[model samples]
Target: MHNFLRFFPVFASTLGVVLAVPLNVSHTTISPAPSPTCTEATTTALPPEQDCFYVPPNGWETKEPGAVLRHRFAPQQPFATDTVNYPAWNILYRTTDSNGDPTYAVTTAFAPKDISTPHAMVSFQFNYNSADVNESPSYGIYHDIKPKLWISKYLQHGWFVNLPDFEGPLAAFGAGHMAGYATLDSVRATLKMSQIIGMPRGADQGVRYAMYGYSGGAFATGWAAELQPTYAPDLHFEAAGLGGLFPNGTATLEKLSKLQMSNWAWSSNLRSVMIGLGTMHKKIREVITSSLGKPEWDWNTVIRRLPQEKEVSRLDLKNAVNTAINSPLVRNVLDYDTTLGSHGIPTMPLMFHRADTDQLSAPEDTQELKNVYCNSGASVFLHVHPNTWDDPHFREGLQACLSEDIQTFLATAFARRLYPGCGTDNRPWGDHQYGPIGAR
Candidate 1:
């Protein structure tokens, strides 16, 4: 592990030189229509409700998964600070649901205008962690500072960043399979639309790919890695970086339900999970709503209206936590979606960054995940951060993006260098005095 870390600076410099020279591939530029179909001329900004772009065209189901159904120049976001004015597009593409039924999803693709040829691509999944369609990345990314900062690093590297609304139109937050399908299919759509995004035609096959996510986003990234071998065998990811992972949704929910009694914030987390699961599975919804009694009739009403209102008060969330925790059917649905190892092991190298004191996701769960992947002969690197005074979950996620180790991992993968074998680094960041604890 130490040897690999020592080689990163040299690899990174070589990668920069390689990326500077555009690929010697044929190019064909396609002009975007001045006025895209299904767009309202009067409205400058179209939310999902009024945006016909979110809806699939007729016969969309006949198209193969990841096929781009419709695309248009994305409306200018107030918070979008692209000084170079990179070409950005809102793409509607074919994808599948958690049940393997044909469906469509939207992805926001940002391309570096200076790059004439395809380079590496990063399919970044956001942790909106909500059941509200309005809060999806396609609509909310520009407004949020954290995501913008996280995405800028990749864009600055001249890599195409594909941000998919992985929760789908329904915003089924906890449905890992659905998120996986949306994520992988988003990559396909980005590749298919390369020419339109200022890359050469047929450059999709030449592009290196990677995936990154944290917290709820990691839930999708982990599933995408696990499902890639079978679901999207044609695509290959050089590396995947997951931080603050929710390894088991069932355990997370059960833990949240028990803790919510004392903490108001935990109740909010429980409500979000319950609403997200209810949106995906009808049986779970029935069980949750059925558990609500006359005393909590208002709580039931609030849950029913959450999709539209997209807000819940602390009091309302507190009233509903018990209703979901006690439902067997809800637990059954979560149990089915929670376990990551039930699916096949990932073929790509994986980097996991976790904090020992993460409040939302238990550190033990991440250890178990690493053990499962290592036992199955998958390459894994686990970096453990020491406990902190502040929220370790949020801090660890931030540290992941800013860490030198993460940059080295991505650089090593993109350069096609030999990745370190399965190992664990328990030393805190900047503690270079000690070598990695567990190297195999």
Candidate 2:
């Protein structure tokens, strides 16, 4: 094992004031179980204490991806799912970072009331697309557009739901591979811990699972789906529901770049993509810093100095985005950092939705992705919705998939009643509705 303690301090110092994340380096790892109200350390400021940990047990990676390093119940607050009659388990499981290096991630599991009830597990990845560690799902912090209410419908159906902090420890926003790896591992951990967490006695006849996500979360879902065949052959997701997917890093940037070939002129998510990639690849970081440099608050120095969990305002980032747009070397650097089509094709049944009004990524990107997957004999159903939600295209696309239709789609999949759309490319967008899908 790499001397984690030897590098732990450096990791803490580099991120500036934030404590190091848990690492399960080996199968023999063990640590004193910590209380949910872990004494907040003095250094864990920018991020809330829940997101930071004093070093986890020595084991960083298990021989198996989903091996659980620790399991405990969440405190009597947000995770206190008891009000809804759902008991929650907070888990630390082995996973890999964007670079494919070993690490550990946190996932929260809420089992159904009749623990032994035959239920499918839902690996519901959320769109916590920010640098804030406190924003990680394990922290139980809810953004305004949070999908808990929609997820609640699943809970009401007695389905098991697992919410993973799939971005890895660094909150890598658009880091697809790492997100996918974490999603798979989180499922593994949740499934293995079901008995201890209280599953109904006989439901374990191989609990089937599926993945659901949108926007940034879809980045994880798409990557996770693509990687599952190779990185997690044991995982067999019955269905995957992806929305607002920004699959190709380059295509997404171009669509969002004000200075690039874009129909929408002012989206700066390219900066977020760069920041996320920087967390994994040093070369990418170097290119980002060179183009977006401003000694007083350059991308590198600011990132190196500030706590990653804190919000970086738009005004604070205008200079960097502008610099990247005006500089060819900087813009070209991102050309090499792509996400779509890199991971192998996923064989799971898939439902991909995008808003016709989405300005963040061109519709052609999804079409291209559908073609790629079909060429590999994968079943993919692509849908492009009309702008029903008047919000920004990105937000509209996000809400598009999280609607009642998605919940019904998931529930149907869990019940084993879903059939493939028999589509090789984009399927016609289903009509909008206020009721459960297909409820004529």
Write one digit per residue (lDDT tens) for candidate 2, span 167-274.
Answer: 766666566777889999998899888788765435346677888887777778888898899999987788898887776676565455443223111322344455
Most accurate candidate by lDDT: 1
Whole-model lDDT values for every prediction: 0.69, 0.61
What digit string (tens of lDDT, one per residue) describes model 1 on residues 1-440?
33443589785445333321111111111111112444541225565655677888889999998999998878764234566555678899999988788888889888864542336778888777766666678876655555676677777777778999998877676888889999999999998888888754453547788998888888899999999999999998988988778788767766666666665545544666666666667666656655543234343354554422135444445455556655677666766666687788999988887888877678788889888988988888887888653556755665565556655566566766635467777777544121221211
Clashes of 2: 13
**TM-score for candidate 2:** 0.76
RMSD of each: 9.7, 11.8
lDDT of 2 at 149: 51
Query: 52, model 1: CA deviation in Å?
Result: 1.0
